[model samples]
Target: MRTLAGYTNIMSAKPGDTVEFKVSSHGPSATFSARLVRLITTEEHPRTAGLIERDVDAAFNGEYPARRQPIHTGSYGYVEHATAFSGLEDFTFQTWLWPTLLGSRRQTIAGTWDESRSLGFALEIDEAGRLTFLMGDGQGTVSTANLPTPLVERQWVFVAASYSAKDRTVVLHQSPRCDIGDLGSAETRKFDIAAVQGKSGQRHFFIAAHKASASDGLLLAGGHYNGKIDSPKLHAGALSIEEMASLASGAAVERLNECVSAAWDFSIDQGSDVFKDVSGNGLDGRLVNMPARAMKGYNWTGQFHDWRTAPHEYGAIHFHDDDLYDAGWSTDFAFTIPSGLESGVYAARLDAQDASPAYVIFFVRPPKGQATSDVVYLASTATYMAYANQTLIARDPLDEMSMGSLLVFGEDDVFLDENPEYGKSLYDLHTDGSGVCYSSRLRPILNMSPNAKYWSFGDGYLTGWLDALGIKADVITDEDLHNEGESILAPYRVVLTGCHPEYVSLAMWDALKTHLGRGGRLMYLGGNGFYWRTAFHPTLPGLIEVRRAEDGSRAWSAEAGEYFMSTTGEYGGMWRRQDRTPNQLVGIGFCAQGFMTGSYYQWSSGSSDPRVDFVFKGVNKGSKFGDYGLSGNGAAGQELDRYDPGLGSPRHAVVIATSIGHTDNMVLAKEEFGAMHWMIGGTENKNVRSDIVFFETSGGGAVFSVGSISWPMSLPIDNYQNDVSHVTLNVLERFRDPKPFSLPQ
Candidate 1:
């Protein structure tokens, strides 16, 4: 467990903007000190500058009281309409449910029952996974009626419960939508009672969970259900067995509309957290913790796949007990960026006397419409958010096999294993085995640490190298480029990218394309970039969504009809699937991947091309230049990209170098082949290689791509005197020049 952990509300800010930090401390000391630091590279390689962080004095740099803020996990919908059910004499609740997983814990389908107060009624699945109807009198008397058969996982079922004060009876009904012979047959149970209480002052009615407590504006929920719930209806009078069966079987309930109290249609607001009530009682509710929307409901058929086309068929809302969107932690301290502060990477350094110090990373951009330098580094913050708090090392069963070595667990991995409430990356699966499509930066992310491996920290090497070379470059995040478009980059002559910028939003893509079209230069120093189609929430900051549609190196595949993101209602998947392959912009696209080992790039035939002669001006005439490095022992391993004419690689693009000598573990990407075979491995396949390419665009713009994630990792080798560093510097110097390049005939 971590003694000190925290996160910032915003990942990037401009001058005069305040960034809030929320810290959680479990140490014996209740006080912690906060200081501001300019982050360079934290790589500990002996050949590199180690642990370089320049301290910046700040007004908020002092001791502050620390408190433990717990995270509540789970997603549900709740409506604050208790007056609708106050002093009710009769009632009925019905819903279409598709259970995914059931454990010893009870799962509420719909309820007003408060577990602590033991009040109201709820339709639920009991601890044994059987359908049950529960009622509480608020005076300590709780009653439950259960069906004999247990529910089958991953199957659709219709359930209903009713109470009649006139008859002093309670009734429950369960019916499966599929064929299961006797076990899946319809069931109805009735219980005789002297009296049934209908008045409990619980303010909120919940779906997929029941209230445990609501104190000080904080809601504590229990009995979180994992699965889909559709077309939930509540009535003011008891519904007969025939009436309930008619409602569940798609018969219209409008004939008896006078008794209708609330009917929630999840498909109404597919992109927002609000659920609309179709029954006209104004009993609308808001979803908590960001449940999965745009799901295929019970009535879905093969006719239409997208929810936008057939919303009625896709009314379901999939809720998971482990769904977490925000930590909701209170701010411990906030620092407003002082005017004229250089735009770059910064972090809040928090320290407790007996605990490990924590660094919450954030980026600072130049003031609006201002340019601090002629060059800019576009930080891949989208990719960082997509991989925040990932647990592939601890939870992925095939992780060791994929890496060709035993997985190593760090302190962060252990902490994530113990506390899943911190949420997971898009690469991970939810508790119910569904792909996690949404990610947020509102919670602590251990992998974003300056000292952590890969992810955001991997880019620090380039920044550190630039600092050492006395180059003045401004920094902007993915969000800034996305929100402002090409205007943000129009002021800079050159743009640089970090390693592993795998996630690309449509806005960011358009901006980069526009930049290249307007005589600007781009240095794509990374691999597997602009591959996945990503979306940022239109109204929510620091949140991103990605759906793994139709394949291309994925941890989990989205459902067939669920390839569209609920955030922007855009199709989610690889950019290549939409005919926008990365090769179209950078002269290369993702080709292959391997872990913990890398290879070197050999001079290709195009090295003699006079157009790219400036790229190798001061470099040695060696056949290969990136033979040694810190990451994977070489500069051309990990995930690699290659120039391919068949996949939109510009015909005039020069392939100056190609990586060679990779182990068999480095296999070709799945998208490269339709059939699986042993020949696809790096040892047998010629396609599994990285290529260094250069091409000139219209308007005198140009692109220089080093198609390897390990390219920057080789910069600090030999104290930044290596061939990789020299070649990169050569390109940077020429790109920084104002000379316009003529298109090759």
Candidate 2:
């Protein structure tokens, strides 16, 4: 346990809406103090500067005690009924499965057993990858039988277990799917035991897991199944081998002669949590933890791409042992944002006597239908959620050189590496070693704290620069823009975005584009903005889905034919690949990235153009624009963007300044090349540089892009007197004017 950590329910709340904080500590009992403080970016480097917090006399401020809480990972479905499987003496259980993890672990595909009491039956994959069937008698005894052949990983196979009470015998069978022949041999095993009566208790039917006992009479689900499971069926009587073969070979349930007690058809209810039983028994089950639905099932022949258009081709539900849609933890504390509270970044600071301090960050929006200032700052909550609780320290080379020499590793980084159960970012892999495609904000996001430096350079630096300049600005989150769309931006004259606003949902993207089209001014303060095409569930809040496909900087690529999101049924990948490139909206697109260090930007020839004289009114033409800052000690570094007309940069867009002197480590983005080679490095490629761009939309709308994630970090240097700050302030002040921008004729 790394100390105290927590996360909030929502990123931004309007006045009168309640916000909840869920905090978890390490010790048995911990004393902690909580207070509301507004966060401003001072410096993100842990060793050099700390987050500047302003005490806000809000409702929460006191010392309290809290108990340690546990987090459970994995997803499964279960059917709970008083008489689900009431009086069945001889029965058979069968399912089509594609196992991802088959090495040495007991995984239950479908079971009606309670391990603590040793009763009921379970058809499971044993530790040695062989099919095992266990039938427990009313008394504390169990009859077990195992198939002779072991199963292979990631291969479709049919498995079944049947018991005949009259004969006192159990048969287990396993065979590979006909489509992918030669995967495994068809085998069966029989076992004889003393005659025992089938007993019924409080045990419920579970798919992908079984009930296991824990300390203090606590019952938890264990033996979680990994990979895909489709059309699990339970018959009232032992079915013959010929009948089982017909069912496995795509026989319709209505045509089958066997009496199915409960048959779950994952193909139905593609949009809901309910899995219907087509056998007409009405023994429907509810999915737990929200497993991936509308996936490609075993019989899928790749005839159609969209699941909605071809439902049968996508019947399987991919269930992972570590798939988490929510933490479901009880709120430790709750407070309503006061009606008069200022709109800014605020957090509930938690300090403990025996543990490290933790902060649950939240943003308070201005009063509904009102704007405190003409300038509104858009917090990249989507990006924050995408990188929530990122375990980069454990996955990446985080030494001083890899993370830049100035990068500082703090205790929070070590804590996340040690305690991975808190959850992981979409960039991480699950316990089964499969790529994590989904991430939710319902759990405690340890990396989104003020004391954390993971993504602080983006949001923290922007807020701190605003505070130091005494700029009065209202704050809104990415979720706010996603939910409300353009109406949210209609109240303000100038809208500003934070650093690294990369992960963008379709709704958010449409809203921003609509705002720009309607003559709304936008100042994109970071690079790599609007990169990935993301999707948010219509009903599931705090959950965003991403499918890494077609190319961009990514940890893993989505499997073939699986690039579409299961939530919205939309194709997932980079926006550029979808024909909505970032350059179209922000005047620049992601170009390159170098983690080692930063460089300075020089004024381009277009900076002296009389048409854009107002943008650089106070800055010197010959002087280097950005040469000093907290992050990397310079303005342009980390991820960078460049203007390219072929990729959708407007014909009238101008490159006002460009970063120079980037090291060879800064390589061109993968999307820019046809092949990977040494020519992609900044030392050889001219396109591997951040281009500060400016463009005007129809009806007086204008966009100013910094094209670098480190640009805002250079604002606080020299008491905010640097040319970077001067140029940014000039744009903001001019953008706030009610007069419509007039393009030179």
- Clash list (residue pairs), candidate 1: none
Model 1 has an lDDT value of 0.88
Local accuracy by lDDT, each model: 0.88, 0.80
- Candidate 1 Cα outliers beyond 4 Å, as residue runs: 179-183, 193-195, 252-255
Give the runs in model 2 whose Cα sits over 4 Å from its true position. 42-49, 178-182, 193-198, 213-219, 249-258, 396-409, 743-745
lDDT tens digits by residue: candidate 1, 354-466: 67778889999999888989899999989998899989888888888778888778777878887888999999999889989999899998888876755456898899999
Measured against the true structure, the TM-scores of the candidates, in listed sequence, are 0.98, 0.95
Q: Which 10-residue window of candidate 1 scores lowest in summed lDDT?
A: 193-202
Model 2 RMSD vs true structure:
2.5
Each model's Cα RMSD: 1.6, 2.5
